[model samples]
Target: MTDRTPGEPTGLDIALQWAELPPEHLKAALQALEPELARRHEMRMLQARLEAQGAEDRRSHLLYLSGLVGGFLIVVAMLTASVIVGINGLPWLSAMLAGPSVLSLAGLFVLRRVDSGTARQVARAHDAALGAAQPTPGAGVV
Candidate 1:
């Protein structure tokens, strides 16, 4: 751990020192700081919201891409099985098609589930942040 002075400057103290204002200016300084601080807080919240939204979008896109690729591979496998059956026999055709079909279905199911769960989580986080940022009725009003 690092050592700190007993009277180390807090954020307000640092701001006051930087501004070279006297103690009598405390109230005015705080009044000025309020809106600036509120704006900074709002910016941070917006950034968080954007990040969450971006993550959800990426997950959705990934799920869609995976499904598309899986479907393509399954179709290719079916065509290959048909060709092999026509050339040699049906003995190995079922074995060749079964694996790809089962894997494609399972992958699609998993991707859908994961995407929905991530979406719900992001939505809940956004709602919670929005609710917290808004004041309750009659609050902070004289």
Candidate 2:
């Protein structure tokens, strides 16, 4: 029987308890245990994959949020510099600085919009790849 509780002996412990068994019986027990061991190994692999995906998703979300925040900060700093330059009587320089800020903000807005369509884009790309990989109906038929 398998262990079911924290204080209970583990499978290895139970196997060790059978160390005194006759050689034939020990070989038979090991053969019977093989399928359970393989199943447990598969379950652990699946759990690890799910956990890794969850962590990757969280890291990606954080990176996206950091990018948006960094973009906003850069725009704000550029506009502030533009205003300071204007007040100090450099009209052309102020306009030059402000132009890029506006462009940067627009870029950030477009990037934000693209995030919403990413899933559709990925699915479309996957479908396109699958379509390209399939052979044409008449190309190979004689």
Please tell me which predicted candidate would have the highest TM-score against the true structure.
Answer: 2
lDDT of each: 0.62, 0.69
Candidate 2: regions farther than 4 A off: 1-4, 7-9, 16-21, 105-142
Best by lDDT: 2
lDDT of 1 by residue, 1-142 (tens): 2123578655567675746767657667777778866876788888889999999999998978877777667666676775676476454444444433444444455454435565565556555544554568999789
Model 1 ranges off by over 4 Å: 1-14, 17-24, 89-142
Q: Residue-wise lDDT of candidate 2 within 23-107, one digit each (tens)?
A: 7877787788888778978888888899999999999888788877777777778788989987997766666557533454545
TM-score per prediction, in order, is 0.49, 0.58
Q: What's the count of clashing pairs in each model shown?
A: 0, 0
Model 2 TM-score (2 dp): 0.58
* Clash pairs detected, candidate 2: none
TM-score of 1: 0.49
